[model samples]
Target chain A: MTLSLDLSHRFQGFTLEAAFTAPPGVTALFGRSGSGKTTLVNAVAGLLRPDRLRLSVAGEVLADTTAGIWQPAHRRRIGYVFQDARLFPHLTVRQNLLYGRWFAPKSPEAAQDFDRIVALLGIGGLLQRRPGALSGGERQRVALGRAILSQPRILLMDEPLAALDEARKAEILPYLEQLRDELGLPILYVSHSMAEVARLATTVVLLEAGRVTAAGPVAVMLAQPEHAQSLGLREAGAVLQGQIAAQEEDGLTRISTEAGPLWLPRVAGEPGRPLRLRILAQDVMLALQAPQGLSALNHFESVVEAVHLGDGPGAMVRLRAGDAAVLARITARSAKAMGLRPGLRLHAVLKAVSVAQENIGRGA
Target chain B: MTLSLRVSAVATVVSLPLGIAVALALARGRFPGRQLLNGLVHLPLILPPVVTGYLLLLTFGRKGWVGQWLDQWFGLVFAFRWTGAALAAAIMAFPLMVRAIRLAIEAVDPKLEQAAATLGAGRFMVFLTVTLPLILPGILAGTILAFAKAMGEFGATITFVSNIPGQTQTLPSAIYAYMQVPGGDAQAARLVLVAIVIAMAALLLSEWISRAVARRIAGT
Candidate 1:
């Protein structure tokens, strides 16, 4: 299902005007703090009535200010998983998980299997315990289970992992990926962490100062030179979707992407399982020709698509290799000496160790 | 003592629901005249006990406006009766009831109520399933305070419903009556000791109940 929103709202000293269409899968609203990501999600969830809005999910109109059509939050059937989980403290985990089911519309299609949801969230062990007795990650898991049991048409997750420690975030991310692959539900996820965006988002909507700066498939948006400043140069990179081709000897794996085959440190997934690789711009090196004397395990022949000169001595070069895009950040002096411009052919080299294990993740 | 217990218990049980409703309005409602309603509910607490009793007598006595209609329509009477004493006690204790309950409701996070809404609960269901259980400690505290105040009510109960033996004479009224007659000092002293013990028990009971409720609700 596709979700579209054109909304405008004014808060104290800030105005949010955003419009974007999120296709099926996870559409991430990515931005720095105060970029109105939460406001946009709140508008979609009917938590905030914007000054002007026209929102629709899968062609069903949720809000239209000009037409005077507004649905209250309870009737919207859109589940929200907040950053803090918001579980009922007065209830045991099982009761909290089933709280929404009591009010769900009575219909076969709206009914979710109780045992299956509990098993899926791995919260069966926590059923008898209250929220105060659960760990932060456990609380979030129960919160997810509660929202899923509500049978929402769409799910809005506002930085659900933002409050967790690194280990806790790691613990929950796999469950999220599993949900994305199996639930068949569209998700609008909000986050400022690019690493998270690169790992989970099928589509990325970049917001800056309450405006949608760019919106497109994650792979395309990540490689655009124009988005370098908004994405924060240190975290700016390209996301390549590929499937594991084979497990090679010497603790290495080969993956095939649109660009070409890539060899990296061994990953745990079986052959044919899709993997998303996050290649940071700082990890990429550019050469006029393929170097035979280097230890880098990955190389791509590409033509420069665009050159973005930074205010400092650095520069970002956008490149197109086959059908996939790659980004390489180098010194401005090198660009001037190499006469880098659109259509100039070059080689992109990447060391195997530069791609950290954390940067590689399973894809839906 | 049995008459006093019955009067106070009846007054508290009858006013409990109304007290909760009024407390919710005071804690959450934002419409016009809220301040006026708050002041009116609290007037009996600040006013002289005799004045409050006189007002109750004027409104609910046999010859008064509501009292005349009630007697003519339903043949009910409050003037110089035990029911009238219960009414006076309830009115006298209403402020303490509302204050404790309102503070409890205010302490509850409205965000939890909003979360309940997102989970498909309407306003009434949200209150029943979320707000009520969370504010139980406050309600218990308020009810105990009101019950204690009603048990000790003397001036207002005597004014609205004259202290008739076996009918309108509550514990405090009986103590006052005994103190008035020669050689009745011993009986008055015994009743005073009983009153002190009841008051202390109510206080300790409230403290224990509130702590247990707090611990259960807090899940700690």
Candidate 2:
């Protein structure tokens, strides 16, 4: 099931007009702050009516301004997990979770079992406690459970983890992954955190100002230099599709990709289980000739596809190694010295430890 | 003292729903004349009590327009009667109640209501299940304030209903009546102590209730 949005809304000093489809699985609306991601999500949830909208969940049309058809938010069956959790402080956690269930008619398939969700979110201990007593992460988890119990056709999470610290965000991620794989429910996740989007989103819609600058499969979207530049040099990276091949005794795991077998720090995936690794652009270095390894364990023979020069001394080099697309960030001086241009045969080198544990996630 | 208690309690109860409705409108409504409505509700707070009383008498006297209409239809009258004392007290206390409740409503996060709406709750349901309960402590404080004000109201009550013994006489009016005659200091002094006791008890009860409600909502 997919949620499609083609809407336009005018705001003072800013206008948000976007059209994008949230494909099955986690489709992330990735953008920096003040990019209007939340407002777009609100339009999908029917909380904010856009000036013009044609939104549908699965095949049911929730709103189409031109068609003169609109549904009120309460009847739309969209489960929204806000950034702040927004849990009713007066109600116990159990009551908060069950609050929405009372209003939604449950089909056998849509009816998420109460105890199972409590277990899924690990919130059974908080059932009797009010929202005020829960920590930030716990509150968000309860909010997610509450939204699910409402039996929504699709889930809309607007930067639900944005308020949490890194540790708290890490704590909630595994549960979110489990929700994606187990529930088979499509979700529209909005976030400025590229790491979260890279880890969870199967599809990426990059929003800038109030418009979608790019949209595609996560792997393709991550390779786009336009959004990569906007994401800043630190988060600019490419995702490599690979499967774990072996676990070396020296605490390194072998992952086989189309490019070649690469060794990295031990990951949790079992042998033969596929995984996605995000190699930062800066972590990769380009060599004009076959480079002898000093300490870098991974280097691939590749051809330069594009060179994007930044305003400063830095440049992003897009390379094609076998079937994989690798990105290398280097100084413009080196590119000019090496005459790095499209179709130039070269080597893309990477430090194995440079791919931090946070940069790796299980395959979708 | 019993008459005073009855008048204040009756006044508070009668005006509770209206007070909440008006407060909600003042806090959230954006309709035309909203400012005018706010100013009118607060007129009794700033205007001299006697002036407010005079206006009420003109509007609700036995032969007054609304009073005559009510008398003919509902057979209800508020002239020189205990009911008149209650009406005058309610008017005098309206602004305090509305102000407290409005502040509470403003303190509530509208984001919670939006969350409820996404959960399939309509506007009214959101209010009943979330907004109303979340603001429960505020509402109680507002009610207690209004009741206290009603208990102490003398000028408006006297001018509107007059201090008729056993009928329109409340605590403050009775105290004033005692002071008007010589050698009635003992009665007036005793009533003054009674008023202090009643006010103290009310303050203590409100404190306890506020603490209990706050603890429940805050989960401390």
Q: For candidate 1, give the lDDT of residue B120.
A: 85
Write candidate 2's Cα lDDT for A14-65 as tens digits: 8998998887888999888999998898988888888899999888899999
Q: Reference contacts recovered by each candidate, as fractions?
A: 0.66, 0.98
lDDT, candidate 2, residue B44? 95
lDDT of 1 by residue, B1-220 (tens): 9999999999998999999999999999999999999999999989999999898889999889999999899988999888888899999999999999999999998878877878888888999999999989899999999999999998899999989999999999999999999999999999999999999999999999988876775667
Where does candidate 1 stray beyond 4 Å? Answer: A107-112, A351-364
Encode model 1's per-residue lDDT on A1-364: one tens digit a residue: 8899999999998999999998878899999999999888888888788999999999999899999999888888888999889998899888998898888977675434778778888888889888988899999999998888888888899999999999999888878877787787889999999878888888999999999989999989999988988998988899887778899998998888778889988877778777778888888899998878898889989999999998999999999888889998899999999999999999988753222222124223
| CAPRI band for model 1 | medium
DockQ metric, candidate 1: 0.71
TM-score of each: 0.95, 0.93
